[model samples]
Each structure stands twice: as C-alpha cells, then as structure tokens.
Target: MSSTPKRVLVVEDETEIRELIALHLRREGYLVDDLGTGDLARTQLSKQPYDMVIVDWMLPGLSGLELTRWIRTELKQLQLPILFVTAKTDPEHVAAGLDAGADDYLAKPFDTLVLMARVNALMRRKSWMDSFNVESEQSPHAHILIGELKLDRDAYEVYLRDEKLDLTKSEFKLLEALMMSQGKVLTRKTLIELIQGDGVNVVGRTVDTHVFGLRKKLKDHSELIETIRGVGYRVKLLNG
Candidate 1:
C-alpha cells in the first residue's frame, strides 16, 4: 500500500487552476488527470477509477457540487474522496459544498503549500483506509454481524438464523444504513441521503419502498427494523 502511487482527477474549468493542482500533485508522486468540464470528468471517471477527486465549485456544465454528489451516489462502494476547490468561501457556499458530498474544501487564491498539505492529508487517510480494508475478508458474519443475523457485505447476502435471505442492492443499502446508525432514528431525509446520497432525486417515500422490501427479506427478524411513524427507521438493538 505504501508504494502504490495514487491517481487523482482534477475537474476545474479554469485552465490555470487545473494545471496548478496537477503540478503540485505530480510533485507529490500522484498521477493526475486534469479535465476542464464536468462531462469530460464524468466520462473519465467511468472509464478509469481515481483514488481521489478535486472538483471546482463552478464548472460551466453540471457544476462541481452536483458532480461530487453524482459520484457519491453512483459509486457508493468505491466511495472516492472529493475535495472542492473554489473561490466561494462564504459560509453558505461552504455548507452547501459539504452537504453536497465534499470530503474537504479549498478556497480560491489558496496557497500552493496549503493545497499540498490538504492533498497529503487526504492521501494519507486513503492509505490508512486501504490498510484497514485488507482485513475485510475475515468472515461474512464477522464483518457485519448483528445478533443472529449477518449482513454479508462481500457476498452481498444477508443471513438470519443460518438461512440466507434474498436482498436487492437497495435493500442492502437500506439495511447497511440502519446498521451503521446503531439504534439512532434515521430521519427519512437522512436515510435517503445516506443510502442514495445527494445525486438521486428520490422523494421521501422512495425510502419506504426499499425498507418495505427489506423488512420482508428479514422475515421474523423484521422486528429489528422499527419504523418511527413520522420520524424514520431504526434498527432496534436486541434486548433494548
């Protein structure tokens, strides 16, 4: 993991800004690809995977924030880290950028040194995650066990009482979302965002479809998924 050079995609409409980022990242031993439009960035992402992405906030088409959200929703498991680089440093802009799915941000007219530092920090975190994932193959139940049920992420299978249950991808995401939240009530909005990110234009009821399907798959164990009426859903811990 230490010796692997990371690939970073720079999506900025500003030519100078794009080049500057590529230059610094190249010096850091990263393979950098600079694209000046969101469409091009999307195409590149689909063709080749990137370890991370640096997107400008104001692209001419499909805006950076939108693009980041797209990546988050469509590439759920890969979950590439995204950094927003832009001149919009106002509180509202920052909040929107983060809410749209940016892992970090850099204001315009930023110092090259600071940009480098942020890049290094992000890359280090990525390296640490890679190291952690190396241990993900221990066992299906060990990875996501909850009482007598097992959420097998690798096999994309769920087992209750040693019987395998059929689950669609959306159902798995919904369950994973609830399990990740422990027993906290996940509001419909939060659950949708957690399962689908900001890209999907899903109404609140869309979550109900997935949850309803998931509840059926869990069968008698369905009691674990508690619907909170006007609130949302929670995975009730056993004995709680």
Candidate 2:
C-alpha cells in the first residue's frame, strides 16, 4: 500500500513566492495547494482539511492575521499548524503573528532551508499527535489526572474542576508533557523535544510562547504547572 502524502496549503499573493514555496514543498514529498489570496484560501480550507497552511502576512482580499484568526475561531482548527511569512521583521510583528494563531513566523527574504525545517517540524509534531490519538483510543486507561485538572488523551479533552478548557494543539502538547513528567523539571530543550520531537530546530522562546498560551488556558489552576527558575516546567506532584 502506498502511504498518503502530507498536504500543505500555501497562501501567498506573490506568484513567484507562491510557486517557489509550492515547488520546494513538493520536492519534500508534500502535496501542495497554492492560492493567491486569503479569501480564496479560506474558501479552500472550508472545503477540506489540510495538514498545514503557509500564509503570507499581506493578502489581497484578507490579511494573513485575519485568516489565521478565522481558522482558529471559525474553523476551530487549533491543532492545525499555520506558518506566517512576510516582510514585517519587527519583534512586535512577530509577536502579533503568534498571538494571531500562527505556529511559526518567518520574515521575508527567508532562507528556504529554514522554511523547510519549520515545515518539517510542524508536520512531524502533527504526525506524532495523530499517532498518539490513535493509540490513546485503543488503550483502556488513556486519561491523566493531577489535582482538579483532567486530561483525556483518547478524547483530546482537558477539564479543569469539571469545566472543559479550550487549548491549542501546542498548549495541549506542552501540558501533556509536563503532566506526564509530574514532578520532574523538564528543561526547555527537553520540553521542545518532547513536544516537537528531536531534530526539529525550534528556538527555546517558542516553548515559552506555547507555555504562555497553555497557562492562559489553565486559568486559576495554572499554578499546577510550575516553572523552575532558569530550568523548565513541571506539574506539581502530590507530595512535591
């Protein structure tokens, strides 16, 4: 049986850029769907599920940020990885892109190698998550409970004091790693490896972004996941 190729949607207004991205992704063995506008991309997204999306910051009909927000809020695809590429290289712009729901940001004149690395990392994470979900479904005990927080791996659900908590895929993965380790302090590198797998060149700050998002969703019980100063993070154990 032939394996299914991963599908990627590239939304870039510049024809040259879009074609370049699509060509590289295709060479990497991914099925590429390229669109010139955010509006068209949104329509395509509604038609079917894509493994990942690469969007430009500026689009003709809708901005990349707007499209990302829609994907997160309207489509409710928190697990879907979105990468933003643009000329905006300021720190604030990068932060805005992440806050707008992009999993990764790349400035214009980006290195093709770096772009491929990020794409591979996101795809690997998604693949791992899909496999984990399948395994959890087959396992009898797929749930973990720490304090009042409960994580059901099989259902891909998290509950705080019986109330469901909304979390992004990255946040969920971070929480899962911490909760699984219990009292063990996971270094940022370790956490990144656990979440994104090894060989993925993800910055340490990326982990912090996911942690911030996770903590925000954790709310009052956010303290359950403690940050070890200059070390990493851990889920507070019952005794320690």
Candidate 3:
C-alpha cells in the first residue's frame, strides 16, 4: 500500500450513521470526510481527490444514483471507487445501484465488519489501479489527439470536438481502447480484456452495453465509433 493513508468521503443524511461510518474508517487508518447531502458531496469532490467514496441512497439534493453518475460521467473519477450503503435492499435496487457505477453495495443493517471488508477490497482495487496508471504513463499512447477528439490519460478526461463527454468508467475504458488502436478493429474479446482486465468473467455483451452508453454520450460524434458486422467496434480514421 502507498504511504499516504487512503482518503474516503462518506455521504449520508443520517448524522449518527455518517459519524459511525467515519469513525470505523478512521480507526482503520483512513482519512474520512463526511457530508449530509449529495450536493455537498459533489462540491467536496470537486475540491479534492478521494481514494473511495461511500454514498447513501437517499440524499437531500441529488440522490445517490444521480450523484454516482455525476462522479463517473462529469468528474471522470473512474479510478475512485464508490460503495453504496442504502436501505433499499431489493434485487432491482441493487442492480440499479451497481449499474449507476457503485463498486459495491451494502444494505442498511449490514454488519460493520462486512462494511470493513468491502472497504478493504475496494482499497486494494484502488492500489492496483494506481500501479497500472504509473506503468501506462510510461507509454507514448498515454495521450492522444486526433481530429477534435482529445483524451488525457493522466487527467481521466475525454473531449470530442472540444466538448467533454459524460462517460462511465467502462465507457471511458472502451473508448480509450478503440482510439488507441488507431482505426484497427478490436474484437469483443480483445475489448473486454482492455476494459475489464485479463481473466475477468465479463461476457462480450457487456461491451455492447458500454458501447451503447458511449454512443449516447457521443451524440453527433457517435459516428466516430464504427461497429463491425460480426466482430466488434473501431474508430474511423480522422484527421486532426
């Protein structure tokens, strides 16, 4: 682990729950910051970087799902892990929370021990991502600019026609892979590895879901991503 203690943001409207979570995290040597509303969490996020964030489902302003999407899409903090802690424990709600970009979900009444385990696991993931970024930075493909598309690997931001596009972590990874391939067709299996890492059990159709999201955000620039008839997708060659 890095010498720096992991930083965590806990967003919960319930004061007692927020403080309790913060206390546990602090005892585990994490630096924890707590907020009472989703809007406040957004403000705090813009001002500082966090290793992980724990968000409640119901917040005063944006709601947990909306805030999670904002963190992924607008803030582009795919590297930052999010754990959802909410009372909504139904299957559909769990699916929705995961789909909204939560790395893990804990229902209300969850044992604090379970919460700690999830937190530790997410932190391990964070460490791996940090190491991966360091190695990737050594490559020439770290930064790309062609036509109006610009991708800043260091900043985790993607811009099309000078406008930044809202993207989830998967969508961002998928786009990065295609653009870096430089017009080469990437099969679904290849793309899955690029986005989800080797040995990850993600089916190829998961790539399709992410592509659909990327295209939606790309809007008029959606044509830049070309789908092959029977294989996968690629980016059309474009001149800067």
Candidate 4:
C-alpha cells in the first residue's frame, strides 16, 4: 500500500502562478491546496495542518510576510516549513523573509526544477524531524537537563529557569544537537548533516543563522551555548 501523500499549501495571488505551482507539486505526488489570499489561506491553515507552505510575498489581504509572522507568533506553528515565492529579489528583502519565518526563498520567475528541488529538500528535512521526535519518545535520553536549561524531546519544548522558550524548528534542532552531544564541539558540517539530513544542499552559514537566533532566544543564559570560533558550537558543561 502506498503511504499518504505529503500535503502542501500554496498561497499566491496570481491565478496562473498558483495553478502552475500546484500542478507541478501535484505531479511530484504532493497533495496541494492553492489559495489566492493570505486571509483565506490562514483560515484554511487553521482548520488543517500542512507539511509545507509556498507563499508569494504579495497577497490581496494579509501579505505573505504578515501571514508568515502570524503563523510563527499567533498560530505558533514553528515546525511548519514556509517557502517564499516573490518578485522581491533584493538581498534585504530575502533577509526580511527569512527573519519573518520563511524556511526558504525563491524569487519570481523561478525555475520549476529549482522550486521542486527546494520543496523536496524541505519535505525530507521535515520527515527526518518527525522520525526523530518519534524515536526520541521511545529512548532513555528523551529529556535533558543541564543547569537551568531543560529540554523535553517528547514535547519538543525548551525551558530555561522554568520559563518556556518559543523557538523555530531549525533553532530547536540546533539546540537538540548541541545538548545531545553536550560539552563536545560539533563541526558546522556535522551539525548541518545532523539537522538537515544527508543530501540537502544546506550551507554552513545557515547553521550560524539558526545558532544566532537560538542564542538570542536563550536570553540571559545565552552563553550556555558556546561558540568555538572556527570550529562549531557546544553546550557548556555544568557540574552537578
């Protein structure tokens, strides 16, 4: 029997573009839902969960960036992968999209092949994460506590001094890897491999971005994640 197809939501205002993307995604065996407005998309999203979202920066109501922010803050669905398809090709715009919570960005007039590749990569990464969560739930080292920091693998939650921290999926994975290999420096290449899975074309700098975000959220205890200069990162060893 075939497994259930991964579901994808495409939020694009242009009918032709939306249909084109939906067609390609469906051809790749993905069950896709295409919406023309961010507000309608948000409503649909609230009713069901999607493995990934492909959104255009411009929308009739609630711009794609605003929708992304809502998904991260209001809906609190940090694990859902978001890919931005936009005409804003400027580096600043791209950075803004990333900062707004998009997992990947593709400028307008994008090549279908590249779009498919990015979608597949994100899907693979999400699949690995889901598997990790399941396996961790069954393992003895499912929960980790170091000093005032606490991580629950089963819940995919992190707490510092008893206060829960909201983290993106990438940030959560980075912290999990460091805590799992506590006190040991993990090279960027190794970290990427562990977090993104094999065969993904994730750059080393992407790891840095996630670590930066993770540390910022770590707040006062940010130093708990140590940067090893040219090497990588490690969780500080706390004496019990």
**Candidate with best TM-score:** 2
Across residues 1-240, which tens digit of lDDT does each residue of candidate 1 receive? 258789999999989889989998998898999999998898888889899899998998889987887786675523466888899989888778876667677888999997886777666655544543564544323457778888765445688988988775557757865775557788887665544422234568999988888888788877889999999999987772
lDDT of 3 at 210: 85
Per-residue CA lDDT of model 4 for 1-240, tens digit only, reads: 028899999999999999999999999999999999999999999999999999999999799999999998788786688999899978888878887778888878999998998888778767655665565543533677877888886566899987899987567778887886678898897677545522135678988888899989999888889989999999989877
> Which candidate tops lDDT?
4
Model 2: residue 64 alpha-carbon error in angstroms: 0.8
Please write out the lDDT profile of model 2 over residues 130-204, one tens digit for every residue.
655565533433678887889876456799987899886567778876776677788997667545532224578
List the candidates' TM-scores in order: 0.59, 0.71, 0.60, 0.70
Stretches > 4 Å off in candidate 1: 138-240
TM-score-sorted candidate list, best first: 2, 4, 3, 1
Q: At residue 157, give the lDDT of candidate 1.
A: 66
Candidate 3 has its poorest 10 consecutive residues by lDDT at 192-201
Candidate 1 local lDDT, residue 109: 91
Considering only N, C-alpha and C atoms within 3 Å, which residue pairs clash in candidate 4? none
What are the per-residue Cα lDDT tens digits for candidate 3 across 78-125?
A: 667888999998988887887777877788987899789778866875
Off by over 4 Å in 2: 137-145, 150-173, 180-190, 194-240
Q: Candidate 4: where is the Cα deviation over 4 Å?
A: 138-144, 148-173, 180-190, 193-240
